[model samples]
Target chain A: MIVAERKPFDEIKESIQDYKKVLVVGCGTCVAVCLTGGEKEVGVLSAELKLSQKAESAPAVFGEATVQRQCDFEFLDEIKDIVGEYDALLSMACGAGIQFLAERYPEIPVFPAVDTTFIGVNKDVGWYEERCRACGSCALAMTGGICPVTMCAKSLFNGPCGGTNQGSCEINKDQPCAWYMIHERLSKQGRLDNIMKICPPNDWRNQTPQTLIQPGYEERIESSK
Target chain B: MKSGSQLEKILTAGHFAFTGELGPPRGTNIEAIKKKAAPLKGMVDAVNITDNQTAVVRMSSMAASLFAIAEGLEPNYQMVCRDRNRLAMQGDILGAYAHGIRNMLCLSGDHQQFGDHPQSKGVFDIDSTQLINMVKNMRDEGTFLNGQEIDEPPKMFIGAAANPFAEPFEWRIFRLAKKIQAGADFVQTQCVFNMERMREWIKRANDMGLSEKAYILPGVTPMKSLGMARYMKAKVPGMDVPDYVIDRLKGVDKKDQADEGIKMACEQIAEFKEMKGVAGVHLMAIEWEHKVPEIAERAGMLPRPQV
Candidate 1:
């Protein structure tokens, strides 16, 4: 899931101070699951903002709203009427959703209330760890399903470097060495010979911002063009 | 005679080689490089100029190698993948070769988190294995990584590092084999304080026939003091400083610890000469270059073999 963390309250407060009415919009999908931006979080932030504004001489009104997913235009349409009442929108969503909201409403300035961290899995209620970098090309097959591109400190394609210390990365003792795990997994599967093969330098040109058209959707892009 | 480097000639001629390391000063101090290279000249086969070792920025190994050359020392210029991409790496390799550097060690450098510039972005576009292969192709095929032909290829005697003490201990030898397969002409191992483990790793490399494929040089760094031993054992990653070594250092007087460290290093060199599949010893007297000559003399490695 796309993990995110709420930006500091001070920064969010400062961004919306100029506006008299600020609507805090939330996303109900990835950010909600990660416990960063959801309906309840929007309420909490709205109440805090209200209290903070009241403490100051110039008080600003804050409103709250959440949609199923801010990335979709259909869910965004549900808030079209209320969005007109606010001078600014403080979006509590990932970078993608925040941009989508800004695109949906061109008049009101949209501000991000959370920092989109990474594509990760929720380890616990409050803990998450990154698992993939989406580097375009994947080498999981030869690497025994371990993603060296994301796991190794140096993103090593070949075997572990001299920095592997007791099956852990040299950068930190808690982080397991990706190549060490790959070696163990391949050795168990009797495919240790896979590690002997040299992996060429990754073709990083695939990482450019690409408009990926799925195979069956190519005709749609052509027709639209 | 790959690159016809002095280290390569010595190793190729079936002579037991000896190499020392020189860490470039943190600033542009040409005299520092010359001073460090002074004692290593005529005492070892070649001197390895480290590249931002331990993540601390220093004079680049390529530039320092030229200074070492001026001091009558052959330098094995070290290149790490941490700071440069393929473009910079290839460019530096060409420039180093143009400056008469024939030996190069490809390494996945220490993470930038361990360096002075902890916030610096590491550009590890290619890991050490890929770097080794890239250099080999540039040397053998006379082509760039893009397969474009080069007008003049850098014919470097490529070297890579090996750690026999790092864990998944059983896999260290296989890693060494993988490095050799990736075109490492010579291998310099991490410091060896645990002789038993080093023996096992070397024996396994021999069993896998890796010894014949590449010249293996076991690294030895004399522990300057008891504190240094403890720091290495506790702080340095992948370092295996045995309890006995620390205990030996602790048994000596505080003033004599440096001498004791030198004594232990000499003893290890003597054992390395007798060990099978061990072609040489890379003595790294970190910041103590003056002691290298004495250690080499005591170890009977003085009057370096003229290949």
Candidate 2:
């Protein structure tokens, strides 16, 4: 899921300093699962922002709202009438959701209240780790299902580096070297030959911003036509 | 002559080759390099120019290697994956080779956290194994990493580092074998302060027939003092300095500890010379280059073979 963290309190306060009333919107999808931008997080952040504003002169009023998902226009339209009541909208979703909110309501100033970090998975209750780089081209098939692009510090496609000590990485002692795990996994599966095949340089052009039409939707529309 | 490198010729000639290390000055001072290499010229076959070792910034290894070549000393140019991407790394290979460097050592480099710039990002576009393979591709096939044809690729005798004392010790040999399979012509290990651990690693390497594939030279760092011994044992990661070594260093007088360290290094070299699959000793007298000649002579490795 997409992982994100709340922006620093001071930075958020400064971004909405000019507004007298603000709406804090949270998404219930990936950000909610990661505990970053959920309904409960929206309340907490709104209360904190109110408290911070109260400490300073000319305090602003804040209203909290959460939707099932922020990326879709239908889910965001639920609060269309009340959204104009606030001076600005503070989105607690990932980058996509924040941008979608701005595009939906072109009049109100939309601001992101959280920093989208990466596409990651929750390791534990409060711990999250990045698992995918969304490089547009995946190499998990050859790497024994381990994503080196996201796990390896350098995003190297080849085998482990010399700094791979024990099973941990040289950059951080706590982080396991991704390539080491790849090597071990491939060796266990008797597919060590996969590691020997040199991967070509990554073609990053596939990652340019563009809408990807779902093939399922496309096929359905064609049959109707 | 695979690459016409002095170290390659010496190792291939079936001699107990002796190599030394030279850590370039932190600043741009060629005189410091000349002074360091001067004492190591006649005593060792080739000198390894460390590339910002330990992540503390230093004169570029390529420039220092050219200085070594100018001083009539063969240089084993060391490069790390911590600072450059594939394009820059490949470009440096051509640059270093054009400047008359014949030997190249590929390493993953120490983490930036250990160096002065802890906040800096590490550019490990390729690891040491990949770096070795890339260099081999350039040298053997005359092609860049992108598979593009090069007019004249760099001709280098490639080397890589190994650590026998790292955790999951059993996997170290297999890593070395993988490095050899990746096109490492020679392997220099992390400093061997723990002879028992090194012996076991060497035995496994020989048993696996890794030596037949590449030259394995055990790294030896002469402890300048008891403090150095303790620092390596306590602070340095992956360094397995046994308790007895510290006890032995503590047993010696403070003033005599340096000599004791040299003596201990000589003893290790003498043993490594006879060990099967061991090619030679890579003396890393960190900041104590003057002691190398003395240690080599006492270890019976003097009068380096002229290949």
Listed for every candidate in order, the interface RMSD values in angstroms are 1.1, 3.3
Q: How well does each candidate superpose onto the true structure, as a TM-score?
A: 0.97, 0.90
Query: Local error of candidate 2 at B40, Å?
Result: 1.9
CA lDDT, candidate 1, residue B69:
91
Ten-residue stretch with the least lDDT total in model 2 chain B: B166-175
Candidate 1 per-residue lDDT over residues B124-160, each given as its tens digit:
8999989999999999999999999989898999999
> On residues A107-191, what C-alpha lDDT tens digit does candidate 2 reach at each position?
9999999999999888999899899878877889999999987898767776465556678876777999897898788879998
Interface RMSD of 2: 3.3
Query: Per-residue lDDT of A9-119 in model 1, one digit per residue for the tens?
Result: 999988887899999999999999999999989999999899877767878888899999999989999999999999999999999899999999989999999999989
Regions more than 4 Å wrong, model 2: A55-57, A106-108, A135-146, A152-168, A171-173, A177-211, A216-225
Model 1 error, position B163 (Å): 0.2
Clashes of 1: 0
- Docking outcome class, model 1: medium
Model 1 is docked with a DockQ of 0.78
True contacts kept of 1: 0.82
Q: Label model 2 with its docking quality class.
A: acceptable
